[model samples]
Target: MHLIIPNWAGVPANIGALATLRSGGVSQGPYDDGNGGGGLNIGAHVEDAPQAVVLNRALLGVLLPASPLWLTQVHGHHVVDAGEVDNVPGAVEADAAIATRPGVVCAIQTADCLPVLFADVNGRVVGAAHAGWRGLQGGVLQNTVARMRASGAGPIVAWLGAAIGPGKFEVGADVLQAFTDTAQAPEAAVGASAEMTPAARMAQTQACFTPIAQRPSKYLADIYQLARIALGQAGVTQIYGGGLCTVTDINCYSYRRDRVTGRMASLIWLK
Candidate 1:
């Protein structure tokens, strides 16, 4: 199976992290691997053959330290403790998970949504967040950082996983407004400028969302840049891995490119 081993620095030696590509399993049809071979479809919720998904997960199991705590992501800001998860994969309703204990793998599945993996410099905690636009707007990344801090973590670093790129992630005016509004409070809290009014702050947020010249009221939102602003507000300055784009990368899956596609996974754990 193809995998992306995060090329980050300062993470403790015991922390292991990787993001999977869509290949090297038994899923067929819409979930087929890049070369039409058996694909690794980890999401049982995506309507692939149940047994095929089961087999794919079994294959994934060989690589993990333990069963990854997979959540039923609602694109909300709910963050769960992976160390506390004991039910089935989809039973927990959350978009992010953190685990301070060893052997508990925090995992996030995504087709086009951004998957972010977090690790403290001291290696006391690790987390994974599924940051789709809705979840991002609702504060999922900030919540994950807060939970890690509450768990006794120190300075945190993040690895941005594959997602829809700005070129393909076109959004309407409402979506633009959501992020603009969400960006304001954080900027203000960081002592942006007392002289800056709400309108100026909103204008500052526009840098992350570029209007498409051909499409009125439509924009290309940079999920990576938006994530950086959120994480920066949360005090996570050491960030990496925001270069890949699922929509254009065949090795990854993109729901926007293929409505009925398999899901990829990003997982992190402390050994």
Candidate 2:
């Protein structure tokens, strides 16, 4: 399993960018490593052993910036400042996290939802967002962008983590409508009506289905495209790494593919 991380233009060169894949752990059964067997499954709530999860997390910490701020992610639009979590562990509940000060890591865990990392050119501010269709349509992306703006960060580099890319995500008319119904929500597509509509929604959604072709009423939803649209709404034109399909990649966990699968954490921090 190869871990992938993409750095955006707004992020400073000194800052490190990385994302972990399913490898190096003590979990047995389906979560097993290819050759080593019994891979690292870091989520405590999963069927994987709690001690194994702790061990996996410890192994991950070798490269992480201190301990990562893990959120109790509920697919909502809430964005919290992890910089404020100075007290203890497992005390934060947020769908999105931002770290403006250095030495702090803003992390997000997701099996299929897009894990978006944001940072400014000066490395003064960094952020992570767990953007499923609901959170994206709600306002998580815009909320993160607003927070980054407040920190006097410019360019606002964004890296799209591994997610259910367009090819594997199938959605009904409701999801097609999710990004378009901005009046019902906010900063959603947050763009023009001509580009995103009931008519073109299917075409737009079907552009990425590889092995799994587009179905009738539903279309293959591209989390990357949706994220780029959201980032565009956030006035962030320079985005990177929208090319991963977690659902298709067996090495990665995909809630869409397996509802009970463990999650992968995408983390970013200032050096």
lDDT of all predictions, in order shown? 0.89, 0.73
The TM-score, computed over Cα atoms with residue i paired to residue i, of candidate 1 is 0.95
Residue-level error in angstroms, candidate 2, position 267: 0.3
Return the lDDT, model 2, position 211: 34
**Candidate 1, residues 150-215: lDDT per residue as tens digits?**
999999989999999989998999998887776566444542234667666677668878899988
Query: Cα lDDT of model 2 overall?
Result: 0.73
Work out the TM-score per prediction. Answer: 0.95, 0.85
Task: Report clashes for each candidate as comma-separated counts.
Answer: 0, 2
Where's the lowest-lDDT run of ten residues in candidate 1? 186-195
Find the candidate with the highest lDDT and give its number: 1
Global CA lDDT computed for model 1: 0.89
Q: Model 2 residue 165 lDDT?
A: 71
Off by over 4 Å in 1: 186-188, 191-200
